[model samples]
Target chain A: MELANIENLLEKYFEATTTVQEEQELQAYFSQDNVAPHLQEYQPMFQCFTNLKAETSTRNVPLQPRKNYLKWISVAAVFVLTTSLFINEWNKQRQAEEAFEYFKTTMALVSQSFNSGASHINYLTQFEETTNKIFKTENN
Target chain B: MKQADFLHTVLPFKDKLYRLAKRLLVSNEEAEDATQEVLMKLWSKKSKIEAYNNVEAFAMTMTKNYCLDKLKSKQAGNLKLVHSNYKDENTSLQKEVELRDSVSFVHEIMEELPEQQKIIIQLRDVEQYDFEEIAKVVDMNPTAIRVALSRARKYIRQELIKKHNYGVS
Candidate 1:
C-alpha cells in the first residue's frame, strides 16, 4: 500500500470510520516486521494494542466465591444487629416497668410513715400539756 | 442467568475488560481487581446484560467505571502511585524495556489529558473500541470522540519525542 493510502486508512482508523477489513489491513500493516521509519512512534501503540488484545483472555484468579459474599455477610450482620437492638429495647422496657412498680411501693410506705409520725407528734404535745397542768396544780 | 452461562458469556471478554481497566488504573494488580469487580457486577446483573446491544462494550464501560472508582479510592487513601510498568518475561529485553518506558511515558502524559480524552484513548487504543461503540459507552458524540482521540494521540507523540530527546541529552 502506498504511504498515502496507509495514512488515509490510519486516519479512518482513528475516526473509527474504517470497515472491519480495513481495520484488519491496518493492523496487519502495522504488525509487519518492517514499519516505515516515519511511523516508528505509532509502532509502539500498534504493538501495545496487539499485545493488549492478545492478553485479553480469562485470567485464572482462584474464584473466592465472589466478593458479593460480603454483601450477604453485611445483610446477615444487619439482621443480627436489628434483632439484638430489639431484644435490648425489650429488656430495657421490662426493667423500667419493674423500677416503676418499686418506686410506687416505696412512695406508699413513705406516705404511711408521714401519717404515723404526725399522730405521734400530736400525742406528745398533748402529753406535755397534761404534765404541765399537773405540775402547776401541785405547785399551787 | 445461571452462573455457568453468565461466566461463559463474559469470560470471552475478560481480556478486553482487563485491558480497559489496565489502561485506566495503570496497574496490573488494580486492573485485575477492577476486572473481577466488573465481572462480578455483570454476573449479579446478568438479567440486564442481555439488554445491552454489545456485551463487550458494556463490560468495557463497567471496567472503566470500576477503575475510576478504584483510582478515586486510591487517591483518597494517598496510596503509592499506580504505575503501569508490569513487565512480561516473554518479551525480548530490548523491546520490553523500550515498551515499558514508552508505556510509562504515555501514562504520565495521559494524566495531563482531560478525562474525556483519556477515556477516548483507552477505549480506542487499549480496548480497541470503535468510535461508535465508544460513543455509546461514553455517551459522547462519535465525531467528538474522534477529535478527542486525535488530540490525545498527538499529545502522546509530542511527549514521547520530547522525552526521547531529553534522554539523549
Candidate 2:
C-alpha cells in the first residue's frame, strides 16, 4: 500500500504484466474512497469496471424444458419408425420364404402330371410304328 | 445435461454474457437478443456443454461471435459501437472529458479504440477473464492478447491523463 509499491504495480499494470492477484491488489487500492492524491486519475477506470460489472440483465430467460421434450419426441418417433420398418422387412422375408414353398409344391405337381401325358404319347407312337410294319409285310 | 443442472452451471453466467454482448453490440435489445440466442444454442447443446472445461468462457466466445456477426449484417450497420458521446474521434485528444463526473467516459474512450483492442479491454479488465480464456474467445494467441491488452490499457491511461491534466487547469 506504500506509494512506491503502488507506482511499481501501476507500471506493471500498464504493461499488462500484472498477475491476477497483482491486478486485484491494484483494484483494491483504487476501490478505496480515500485514494492518494496522485492516483485519483487512475481510480475511475477501475471504478468504471466495477460499475460495468454491476449492470445485469433485467430479465433472465430460464432454460426451457420444452426443448428437451420436443427433441426426445422426435428421437422416439424416429426409433419407432425404424423399429416398425425393420419388423416389416423381417415379415416380408418370412412371407417370401413361405410363398416360395407353396410355389415349389405347385410346380412339382404340374411337372408330374405333364410326365404322365408324355408317356401316353410315347405309347401311341409305338402302336403307329407296329401298324406300319404290318402294312409293309402285307404289301411284300 | 439436466435442466436443473443447466440452471446451476451455465445460467450462473447470464449477466456476464449479457454484459459481453452489450459491449460488442452496444444496444441493450440486441445484446439481450444475442444473449438469449446464445443461451438457447447452448441449451440444445447441453450434452456437449459438459465436455467443455470452462462453459462460461465458451458462452462468452459464443456471445462475442454472435454479436460480431450481428454487427456485420446489413441491418445492424446503424447500431453504434457504444454510447454516442463521441461523434468525432479526433476531438478525444483536444476535448477535456469529465472523467470523475461520468463513469461512462471510459466507455467513450472504448468507443474510439480499434475493435480488437476494445474487446480485449472488455474481456480482460471488465469481464476479468484470464489471458488464455480471452485468447479462446478472441481467437488470438495469449501473447497477442496480452500485447493488445497492454496497448489498450496504455491508450486509456494516456487519454485519462490528458483529460485529467485538461481538467486541472
Candidate 3:
C-alpha cells in the first residue's frame, strides 16, 4: 500500500471507522521487516502489539485447591472479626452493668449511714432536754 | 462457572498476568502476590468470569487494579523509598539488562502520562488488548481509546528520540 493510503487508513483507525480487515492490513503493514525510516520509531509499538502473546506459567501451580483454601481463609477471617467485635461489645456492656450495680449499692449504704447518724444525734438531744426540765422543776 | 472450568480457562493466562503485574509493580514478589490475589478474585467470582466476553482482558484489568492498589497502599504507608530489583531469568544476562533499561525508560515516560493514558498504553500495548476490548475494559468510547493510544505513542516516541538521540518522524 502507498504511504498516503496507509496514513489515511491510520487516520481512519484513530477515528474508529476502520473495519477489521483494515485493522489487519494495518497490522500487516506494520509487521513488515522494512518500515519507512521516519516511522521506524513506531516499529516497536506495533511489534509490541504483534508480538503480544498470552502469558503462560511453566511452574505447575494447582489453582483450584489454593483458591478454595483462600476462600475459606477469607471467610474465617470475617467470621472471627465479627465474632470478636460482638464479644467485645458484650463484655463492655456487662462491665457497665456491673459498675452501675456497684454504684447503686454504695449509694444505699451511704444513705443508711447518714440516717443512723441523724437518729443518734436526735436521741441525745431528747435526753439532754428531759434532764434539764427535771432539774429546773426540782429547783423551783 | 465451575471452579474447575474457571481454573482451566484462567490458568493459561497466569504468565500474562504475572508479566503485567511485574511490569506494573516492578517487583517479582509483589507481582506474584498480585497474581495470586487476582487469581483468588477470579476464582471467587467464577460466574462473573464466565459472563465476561473476554476473560483474559478481565483478568488483566483485575491484575492492573491489584497492582495499582498495592502501589497506593505502599505510597500511603510512606514506603516509596524502597526500590524493586526484579530480573527475568528467561532472557540472557545481557538481554536482561537491556530489558531492564527499556522497562525503566518506559516506566519513567509512563509516569508523565495521565492515568487514563498510561492505563491505555499498559492494556493496549503491554497487555495486547484490542481497541474494542480495551474500550470495554477501561469503560471509554472507542474513539477516545484510539486517540489516547495515539497520543501515548506520540509521547513515548518523542521521549525515546530525545533520550536516545534517535530520529523520529
Candidate 4:
C-alpha cells in the first residue's frame, strides 16, 4: 500500500471513521519493521493494543461447582419426593382396605340383627293364630 | 442453554471480557475477579443467554457496570489507576527498557483520560469492537460513540506527541 493511502487511513482511523479493513491496514502497516519516520509516533498506540490483547488471566474459570452441587441436591430432592409420594399412595391403599374390611363386618352385623328381628315377628304371628283357634272352639 | 453450549458460545471471548474489565478496573487481580464474576453471572443466567442478540456485548456491558460500581464502592481506593502490562520479550535489553518506559508514559496519559474515553479507547482499539457493538455495550448511539472515540484518540495522540518530543529528546 502507498504511504498516501496509509496517511489517509490513519486520519480516518483517528477520526473513528475507518472501516475495520482500513484499521487493519493501519495495524498491518504499523506492525512492520519499516514504518515511515513521520508515522513512527502512532506505532506505540496500536502496539499498546496488541500488548493489551496479549495480556491474559491464567486463572481458571470456576463454572458450575455450586451448580453441580445444586444439581445433585435437586436429584436427591426429587428422589425423596417420589419416595414420599409412593409411601403416601401405599398408606392410602392400606387405609382403603381397612375401611372396606370394617364396612364388611358392619354389614354382616346389620344382616344378623335383621334376621333375629324377623324370627321374633314370625313367633308373634304363630301365637296370634293359636289364640284365634281357641276362641273359635269356645264359640262353637 | 446447556453448559457445553454456553461454554462454546461464550468462553472464547473471555479475554476480551478480561481486557475490558482490566481497562476499567486497572488492577490485574480485580479485573480477573471482575471477569470471573461476570462469567459466573452469565453462567447463572445461561438459560436466558439465548435471548440476547449478542452475548458478548451483554457480557462487556456487565463488566463495565461492575467495574464502575466497584470504583464507586469503598474498594475504590484499591483502584490502581494505571499500570503498564506490556512487555516485549523479543527486543534488545535497551529497547525493552525504552519500550517499558514509553508504555509507562502511555499508562500515565491513559489514566488522565476521562472514564468514558478510556473505556471507548479500550473497546475500539484494544478489543477491536465496531462502533455498533460499542454502542450496545456503552448504551450510546453509534454516532455519539464514534465522536467520543475520535475525541479520545485525538487526546491520546496529542498527549503522546507532547510526551515524545519533550520527554524523549
Best by lDDT: 4
Scored by lDDT, model 3 comes in at 0.71
Candidate 3 residue lDDT tens string, B36-113: 888877776766765778888788778777777888888899886244664464898788666645434555676677
User: If you superpose only chain B onto the true chain B, what TM-score does each candidate give?
Assistant: 0.77, 0.80, 0.73, 0.83
Q: For every model in order, what is the iRMS?
A: 3.6, 1.4, 4.4, 1.3
Docking class of 2: acceptable
Candidate 2 root-mean-square deviation in Å:
7.3
**Which is better, 1 or 3, measured by lDDT?**
1
Task: Candidate 1: list runs displaced more than 4 Å.
Answer: A10-23, A61-140, B82-115, B163-169
Using TM-score as the measure, the top candidate is: 4
Which 10 consecutive residues of model 3 chain B have the lowest summed lDDT? B80-89
User: How well is each residue in B1-169 modelled by candidate 1, as lDDT tens digits?
Assistant: 7777777887777877787776677677777878887777777677898898888878877777777777788789999655666556588878766655665456567767776677777767765667778887788887777778878777777777787768622
CA lDDT of each candidate?
0.74, 0.82, 0.71, 0.84
Error of 3 at A137 (Å): 38
Could you arrange the candidates by TM-score from highest to lowest?
4, 2, 1, 3
Return the TM-score for each candidate structure: 0.64, 0.69, 0.57, 0.70
Model 3 chain A scores worst on lDDT over the 10 consecutive residues at A52-61
lDDT-sorted candidate list, best first = 4, 2, 1, 3
